[model samples]
Target: MKRGIFIVLEGPDRSGKSTQAALLKTWFEALGREVIVTREPGGTYLSEKIRKILLDPKSRIEPMTELFLYETSRIKHTLEKILPALKAGKVIISDRFTLSTTAYQGYGRGLPIKTVETLNRIATLGLKPHLTLVMDIPDKVFARRERAGEKLQGADRIEREPDSFRRRVNRAYKTLARRPGITRVNAGRPVAEIQREIRARVAKILKRQAWKRGNKKQ
Candidate 1:
């Protein structure tokens, strides 16, 4: 069986990556494709536990320590969920992946980009997403959305950071998207418009893949 495409949606918090991921999964499924929707730091049981530790506001972990924990979660998620699904020819729509680590830790936390990239490679085991759709929104829009949500009993350490940190994270995401195989989507638009843009992109990718397979068969 052909290996399935791995697509990731990445952005700062409240950028609607999760919503778009779900919508893309449904759209792909409607086209008779098997699609799996999953998220980083919480895709597997082990990862979910790590996610709790990482996200807890009370936790006072060091920067490197936090990065390692995220890598650990990603390694487990890749092995237990992503690899098997791809081998079975199912498209995997990941809400966040290695990019988050790079942005959050490498940029937001001021970690060296080279070190973060090395760790990310190990975490992913050389697997790269076939496509990455980055949702880009202004920092002001992100802040508005974040504040609109109910205040949690306690905010995570990352969430508690000043707006400057989040802005750096967003900049990192945009930089990453400039690399090959990543598509930057303007997420500042209306929800319906964003969804339509994503659908069109996915359709084009599917068509190209189908054409490639047909040629190989012929």
Candidate 2:
């Protein structure tokens, strides 16, 4: 059987990664594909438990400790959920993934980029996403959203971080967007417009995958 595509929606907080992920899943299903919508740091049972600790506002976790916890959650999520889904030819639309770690911990927290990359490779066993949609929003738009109280309800530890940290993370995402296999989407636009751009990109990926499979059989 042909291996399935892995698409990740990665961005800073409240950038509509979750919303786009859901829309992507629906679009894939409409194409008669098996779609699995999941999130990082909380895919499997144990991972979900770890997620609570990682996101709890009261948890005072050191930078290295936080990094390890995320990687731990990722390894479990990969082995128990992601790999199997892909093996079964199911498209996996994840809310966040390794790029998130690189952005948040490496850039946002001022951790060593090389160290973060090493841990990421170890955790995911070098598994890479076929497509990563990096949702990009301007600082002014982010501020507007905050003022509108969009994600203020029971904010997580990361969400509640100070302005400086958020600025670092926002910049981190823009930097990461330069990497190959990642598409940066202007998330400040209307939701439908953003989804249309995402769908166009996803269609190209799916088409390419189908072409490759056909070539392999010939």
Candidate 3:
């Protein structure tokens, strides 16, 4: 069977990654493709348990412990969900991936980058997304999200972090965007506009992959 592409939408809190992922899923379904939409730290039953702990503001988790929990959840998610779907040739749209760990734990929580990368490798077993869309929003838009009560009533533990921590996380995402397989999208614009750009980028990848498969078959 032909392998499917893995695409990830990653960004800081209130950056609309989940919304964009949902839009992508719908768009891909309209094109008659087999697609699977999953989110990290919560893909499997056990992983969701870890997710609840991670997102509980009342819980005090040490930086390394938090990082370990994330990796553990990812291990279960990858083994139980991601790898199987990919093997079945389903286009996987992940809300976040290993990059989130590096950004949130390594950069946001001041953990060692090398150590985090090592753990991530172990958890993912070297699997990686074919493309990653990193959303970038302006401070004004973030403030608006807060003012609209999106941040006030719906924030997870990480979402409730201070401005300094969010700033660091944002910086890490920006830096990650410079790396290969990562595309930065300015999400401060209207949702439709951003979605259009995302579709365009993904279309190119699908086209290229189609071409490659044709050549192989020929």
Best by lDDT: 2
Pairs with steric clashes in candidate 1 = none
Better of 1 and 2 by TM-score: 2
Q: Which pairs of residues collide in candidate 2?
A: none
Off by over 4 Å in 1: 1-3, 146-153
RMSD of each: 2.0, 2.1, 2.1
Clashes of each: 0, 0, 0
TM-score of 3: 0.93
For residue 182, give model 2's deviation from the true position in Å.
1.4
- Candidate 1 lDDT over 1-218, as tens digits, reads 65588899998898998778878888888878898889887899999999999988889999999999999999999999999998898999998998899999999999998999899999999899878889998878876775233475667777888978878998888888787888999999998899999988877877898899999999
TM-score of each: 0.93, 0.94, 0.93
Error of 1 at 150 (Å): 9.0
Compute the lDDT for candidate 1. Answer: 0.87
Candidate 2's TM-score reads 0.94
Which ranges of candidate 3 are over 4 A from the true structure?
146-154
Judged by lDDT against the true structure, how good is candidate 2? 0.90
